[model samples]
Every structure is written in C-alpha cells, then in structure tokens.
Target: MTATDDKTVVREYFNATGFDRWQRIYGDGEVNKVQLDIRKGHQQTVDTLMGWLEADGNLAGLSCCDAGCGVGSLTIPLAQAGAQVYASDISAKMVEEARQRAEVALEGKNLPTFEVKDLEELAGRYHTVICLDVLIHYPQDKVQGMISHLGSLAESRLIMSFAPKTLFYSALKKVGEFFPGPSKTTRAYLHREADIVKALEAEGWRIERRTLTKTQFYFSRMLEAVKDQ
Candidate 1:
C-alpha cells in the first residue's frame, strides 16, 4: 500500500467509534483481572529490560522514549523509576488518556513528556527506546524501516514486541480478525522471529534477550537489543 493508504488505515482505525469502546474497556476497573494480566505481561518484559540496564553501571540519568505509549502502562512506571521519559502516540485520544493516567500515577513525582506524534517524527536520542504493540499496524514491507528508525532514536537499547508467527498463532489471529472489536489499529501484522531478528540486524542492532507469551487473545514476542554504537 502507498504511504497515504497506510496513514488512512491507521487514522481510520484509531479514529473509529470502536476505539472509544476500547478506551472504556481499558479504563474500567470492573475488568481488573484483565488489566492485571496485561500489566503482568508488560512487567515481565520490563523486568528483563531493567536487568539489561543494570548490567552497565554507567547507565544512570538515562532518558527513555516510549513510542506508541498507550495509557501510560510502561511510561508511568518508567517515569516513577526516575528515568526521563518521552512518550508519544499516534492517537490523540490515547495520548490524552495517557496524560491523565500519568498525572494520577505520578502525582508526587515528575511526569514524562507526552505528545501525539507518529514514530517517524520522533527526534533526539534516548538511552532506551521502546515500541510495544505498535509495529503490528505497519505492513510487512515497512517494518524494517520502522525498526531502523526506532533504533536511531536509541543510544543504547531498544525493546519491541510483535505478534509471533506460527501456524497456531496465525490461526488464533484469524479468529481475532473475525471478532473485531475496538482498537486503535485494526490491521495486524504477525512477524516471524527470524524475520524480526533480521530486520533489527540490518539496522545494526543485536538481540540480547527474547521472551514469548501466549494469552487467549494473542501471542506476543518481545525482544531487547542494543544498538551498535
């Protein structure tokens, strides 16, 4: 698809009425279990990243950028940990909710800088750059370029997640496609581990750790890598 087509699809999905429904689902406390599971999954990935950061003693005063930061899930925690954070999302509503959530979670602490912008508009280098559940919206042909761009925004580390590629996983994804619900982006692209590695390697990033999680709705693979400096 052309760039315009890509943007249109993204805009439609994020701006659609379905997203409003999703925001309510995500923001409601009635579904605490679902939220907890989601948090647990993200925390697992964050723990792995923290371990990597600790390996190098000179990593303090680090700045982190959370591209596609939704509802401040990882963003607020990172900010609470005293890291300078810059978070951005393509959806205006998502950014607004994230800002509100951050205000409450970071009431007595410094807040991360939040904005509504696409990954391509991101500027400045951070010690760590995270793009989670964001790349799935991009077409297969554009993933490598997107990865390279994210890598450039990081001075030391980059962590990203993608839907895994497997027969079982693909079948499950197809089922999800059938039961369409409100999400910022509707189109999902599953990536093979080998292909994901190749894309990062092409941008001179070396994978340091990988983790896979299988949930009822999705199978996610997260990777932590270091940019070749």
Candidate 2:
C-alpha cells in the first residue's frame, strides 16, 4: 500500500479500538501473557533511549519531538525530565489520550504540545526527533521517504524503532498474517537494519547507538542517529 493508504488504515485503527487496546497495554492494566511481554519489551526500549538522553546532558530545555507518540509513554517521561517536547500522532484519539495522560503525569509541570498529524505532515526542527514503534505500518519504500522527512526535522538527533526483518521474524510475521486479530487490522512491516542505516546515512545522519528489544511476541530494533558533523 502507499504511504497515504497506510496512514488511513493506521489512523482508523488507532482512533477506534487501537486506542483502547494500546492504552491497556501501555498502562498498568490487566493483559494476557503476550501483551504483558510486549509491554515489557516496549518499556525496555523507552528506558534505553531515556538513558542515552540522560547521559548526553540534563534534559532541561532540550527540544524534542515524540513522533507518533501514543498515550504519552515516552512523552510524559521527557516532559518530567524537563525537556521541551512536542508530541504528535496520526490519530486524534491517541493524541487526546497522550495530552490527558501528560497532564496527569506532569502534575502542573509544562505539557508537551500534542497534535494530530501524520509523519509527513510534521514540521519544525528539534534537538531530537523520535519516531518509536510507529513505522511498522509502512513498507520499506515508504519508510525511506519517512526517514528523510523526519531526519530533516532533527538538527542533532533522531531516534526510531521498528520491527527488524530477519529470516526467523519474517517467517513468523508471514505466519501471523494468516491469523488476523482485533489489533492486527493494519499491515505490519519489518525492515532490514542495513537498509535503515543506509536510509539514515543518505539523510546525513549516522547511527550512534543501536539495540534490540525482544519478547515472546514483541520485537523492535531501536536506533539513535546524530547528524554527521
């Protein structure tokens, strides 16, 4: 499907049942074994990224963008860390949830600007731009364009996470596609790490850090890239 087509599917899914399903998974709520594992894996990705940011310097006054921020999982922490965060998601419902959650999580602290926008529509330069777990919906061809767009908005850093394509995971994904579930409404795309790196390099960014988070059902490759100076 085209990027626009994928965006439609993603927006529709997230604006409806996708919001409910993810809110539960990202929250301290009851979930099945697979979901619980996914939650853990997702948290590990956030924590790892947070650690890397903290090591760079104090987050105070640092400008960042949480592209496709859902329920403010990373947005909340970034705000609490005193970063100036602008979080956006394709789904209005997800953006609303993220704003509400940020309000409660920040406790009168400054809230990040939340907007309903697709990745292509995102504008402005940030010290760091993060697009986490949001690229699974688009194929590699579309993802290359997305990487370039997002890279242009980051002055110094860009972080992204996607389902990594491997022989084992590719087979598993194909098998999973045969059985559709409530949360499987959108197409999930797996990307080769080398391909992603090449795309980033093409945009004048170089990978600085990389890690993989995996569980029984969840797998993501998290990468941090900085402008090649």
TM-score on alpha carbons, each prediction: 0.85, 0.96
Misplaced by over 4 Å in model 2 are: 177-180
* Candidate 1 residue-wise lDDT at 171: 81
* Sequence-dependent TM-score of model 2: 0.96
Error at 41, model 1, angstroms: 4.4
Off by over 4 Å in 1: 1-3, 16-18, 32-60, 177-185
Best by TM-score: 2
The residue-level lDDT of candidate 1 at 104 comes to 92
Query: What does candidate 1's lDDT look like per residue over 136-171, in tens digits?
Result: 777778888889898888888889988777887778
lDDT of 1: 0.75
Q: Please state the error at residue 184 of candidate 2 in Å.
A: 1.7
Error of 2 at 30 (Å): 0.8
